[model samples]
Target: MTTTKFLTDEHLSGRVFDGGWTTVASVSDVTEPATGKAIGKVGMTDAAGIAGAAAAARKAQKGWAAAKPDDRAAVFPKAVAAGYEYWDEIVEWIMRESGSVRAKAEFELTLSLKAIQIAGAMPYEAQGLVLPSETGRTSLAKRRPLGVVGVIAPFNFPLYLAMRAVAPALAVGNAVVLKPDPRTTICGGFVIARLFELAGLPAGVLHVLAGRGDAGEALCSDDNIAMIQFTGSTNAGRMVGQNASKHLKKVSLELGGKNSLIILDDADMELALKNAAWGVYLHQGQICMSAGRVLVHKSIIEEFSARLAEKAKALPVGDPMSGTVALGPLINQQQLDHAKSVIEQSVAQGATLLAGGTTDGLFLAPTVLRDVTPAMSAYNEEVFGPVAVLVPFETDDEAVQLANDTEYGLSAAVVSKDVARAIALGERLNCGLLHINDQTVNDDVVNPFGGVGASGNGTSIGGPANWDLFTEWQWMTIKGTPPAYPF
Candidate 1:
């Protein structure tokens, strides 16, 4: 609404973003995040675009993969240099094109810059392993590139979500083709492509296909694509799974999560509010790993509930570009409506609204819900917007049970001053990334990421542990004289 130079269907550059001028940018008509109306028109990448890109990748991936791991690692610094040069400019565009608030966009850009740096020096992290003393078996197997990697990124955390694959996929010696979510294609993929290109990297090693859903479908199902990396809703994740399964291709999914937070009685009342609020309301609760359902210790439930309501009421809500804004607009109207309907439906089913359940002009107010039970649909779902449900628990055992009740086990947090209780509760919580005395979103660059079940498949995305997501171990055999196993 502010900057009238709309994006292009063909992703030309930051200056020339004219995506079909279709008002609603879409390859196959992308549904607006706010209105659910097709707000923009995008060009369709036919089968040939997929084929051509795949063909280009087939040629480049071999050479890229054959290069030493250290050589591949060098690309990161070059990328970082290019990225840092345009950090502020890109941050502004991330706000404009992706609708990210200034601070969140800066957070994303900064995190991505750090991720690139970490990856630059990660050739050591991608190490080969050897096994000995297994009866005539002295094996050393190294990670091999999955040839062409197809990355389908979601729009919510555009930079973070998209690069989650790019850094590792490239680090493990794979060529990549990134298909960005239609709504924020310009801010996400095109920007990355521009940066990588500016870094003086070889072309075709990484390509940006800027079309819509049809392009993604074509890319995911391509025979030439060795592996697929996806991050989005479970329904879309399921479709990607089905397509990959049809080809028996390897796929890594960071899908839907219904993360839960536990606030034990021993936790500092002040700390719990800050951490829970960060986990639930930050990014408008648009993160897949958002801690939407919280189980508070009954002893402190009354006090915790009051503080949470006040916090939600206090979070500044408005245009993301506005510096004073705490909560930005839900990616679009559809999300706002969906989030609103869930809270409304819960209220209809006897759930108590503690604070802030309102939406206007793409802004969904930070909401707090009490008297929530597992029976309500909102209790077990990924709201993908700012809505927190408070469910009080009688004991630690009951708290653990309540937290683990959901089908999703992506991430969870245990808040308590007792170190033993935090660790004990964290172990029993049953999720990918468990935080003790902290919010689920807190992490170091070296920690292993990902969740169990529908949260995510595989390990995680930081520090020394993140490389496992891009590799598979193979047991190599050597014959002394016709090797045979002794049972």
Candidate 2:
């Protein structure tokens, strides 16, 4: 592991890096979600203050975009190295603020560093095209960076989600104004600013702001911000889209999911059971791609339900820092209450609580529910907790139909030993990502990640897709000599 110079607790506050870490605004105290202890505080700026940050970013963007691509690429090595150096510090903040276990926190940090490295290389990877033209003329098309981009990231997977947009935006020569969920400001907003600074990024290139909905609205509505990239709930995404539409700004959204994990009759039972637990219980199921629904072949429903229940019971749940705990707390008390209410309502609607449905403070037990129907609340809604519902399906056609029945199309998985059959069934599932013979919760630095329907407008992120999302194409045509009179 890489190491940074020792940092005191005082250095982690939401200090602005307009030039150096300086307190520019009042801060809000951040509490650990699991223990409800005051862990730290983050700077909170009002609408006007956020706009000031955006203005600063807009100004810096001009020069950054004008710089040579190699110069821009040079920044990533330092940024990536800094990421390694600060890995432990940031992971502690991630665990405390986002309620992530050590494993999930490490995964977020690893991916965040890889995201920066990948984005840095994108400047050179962009290729312009020469096109055929009329005689004595040439036609060419090139991609240019968009102007300042506003990023609004969610609390869950705070570091990875925010950097997912910020790294790419900066790599493509655009400035960024990032607004992290206030609940996760320390890890999501404050530390991110420090990381870029350690990478030797110039002032005004990246700005981090912490606030509630009002501040997010301000960032999106700013005329100077050319585009907005958002990752959050579906309802919040709708508001983001509407606000951006008012100015017709470019937008990319990765919203919510009610993803399904389907088990075919030929699936390896042991693998299926293990993946099922990993898919739904990781990070306490706060992930957007978490397997909300598990559709099992009716012939194996009883056996799968029993085994999954035992698995859920066996997984450790406690404080995230324990290192041995597999499940951590929800992000806050509101989420805990919501999880409980959803389970209760589902039970009232005829779903059976199979293994766990209990909560101790903000920490909920790994829950598995069986006999869930299409009409139940848990079946149709995203619980956003460590709750997985089992619904039986007799045929592949039925499984596919049931999976596509919801408005969400973010992710789906099909587990089966037969490759051809699983591939065929995967084709029929309506989601942005499919994990054949695996589970629904999966992500990579390379893969087009996004969704359709209410989940999002089908914009993609990752790999070359980000280049396409973050830049605009321009066509140029020139005559070799003066043209003759038109026919």
Candidate 3:
């Protein structure tokens, strides 16, 4: 294992830490000797390790929940301080471990800092309310935090998405036990746990366990876990939510999305093509909200596809550390295989591959598909890879229909130079977030971010809504005035 300093204030230089890559399991390490790339091994955690963390959280949550909101907020400002201290190394390791290029990795670190700041400044919103009653005496509404939150994260955007739940889960006074993606385990939990310690948090307030899905499931099914915050595939999400239902616990799932990008006839042609290309290919398109389906106006379908093809062909592909490489490998061999299989099946069903669609090692080329239909699996299913299927539509109504065709409705986009047209399309698209003339405008802080249907419910973010997600509300009223209206 190799421990590195991701970030910390100068005073806590020795305090900040990340576990070196530890070999937890697997027959042999997946490696490409030619390029020196290592696909990580599967990892596990014993039942005792899980039970120990759960016990610590249950004990810590009791006092943390009773502590004032301001007391909780105090830890966050220091986390932000740590962000600035280790910004460079944070981005550097992100690029190396997750295979994300420098630009995207840098952006993720900056956004994480912003989220920490937003979560720390949420005390005013956490306080309960006193209400005026029609009867006579006092009426009150109280908000109570759930005890412990088990955060199970996926590999993509490892830090960015994990922190989304981490901030609010802790800010609302709940203890946290995080189970990071086995693929990106050490980067999220080990790195993040050290920062919490540097922020002056209690030892048991946050526990990092490096393990696979089974370890996480154990935590979720335990009687002590008050909530489960999950981000992953639709199939796994269903099982997680089902288990949490048995215990009647709260949950937040930011699952898969077959998100669409609608290019209206009025779009800024040059701008739309560039932005869409960036959104579909960045981080090898492992992002859930990444635009996988393109709805093009019939009037400009051919023209836009040609332009998109040219832009995609220009993206350089190589190792992430190369700095000049436009695209990087997927996290492991499994994802690379899945991306290839999806493309091959789509091609067999008559979709034409436009720019790039082939795999080498863990690298899948940026690809574009023409003449796609909703009946195809790629149309409705979330393809967490660098692939896009362009469908032509005669009008705005047809475009909206295509965008809403998927069971997953996490995000969507509208590209148009006309402000009114873009706004209209944004309003009509049934998604948690909408982008207008932009590839992606993902702000990870200060908002209630979540979706419906297979995407799951309960927002885990900073804002008034953030507080409500982690806590339940109950109303109280005096009985004196009730007799006045009694029948």
Query: TM-scores, in order shown?
Result: 0.87, 0.97, 0.89
- Per-residue CA lDDT of model 3 for 1-487, tens digit only, reads 2255553233121111112222332322323211556633324565566776788788988888878777888999998887677777767657777888888888888877777787787654736788977655788898777888888988888888888788877887888888887666545655577567778887687876656667777877888788888889889988888888777888777788788888889877888787788778878899987887888899998999988888888888888876678888888777777788878888888888898887777787789988888767677667788887788999888888888887777778888888788888779877887777776536657666776677666454445567777777888776664464556
Where does model 2 exceed 4 Å of error? 1-10, 482-487
Ranking by TM-score: 2, 3, 1
Best by lDDT: 2
Error of 1 at 215 (Å): 2.4
C-alpha lDDT (0 to 100) for residue 434 of candidate 3: 77
> Deviation in angstroms for 365 in model 2?
0.4
Q: What lDDT tens digits, residue by residue, belong to model 1 across residues 271-304?
A: 9999889999878898877887888988898899
Displacement of residue 399 (Cα, Å) in model 1 is: 0.9
Q: On a 0 to 1 TM-score scale, where does candidate 2 land against the true structure? A: 0.97
Clashing pairs in model 2, backbone N/Cα/C closer than 3 A: none
lDDT ranking, high to low: 2, 1, 3
Per-structure clash totals for the candidates: 26, 0, 1
Backbone-clash count (model 3): 1
Taking every candidate in turn, the Cα RMSD to the unseen true structure, in Å, is 4.9, 1.6, 4.6
| lDDT for predicted candidate 3 compared with the true structure | 0.75
Identify the candidate with maximal TM-score. Answer: 2
Residue 64 in candidate 1, Cα distance off native in Å? 1.7
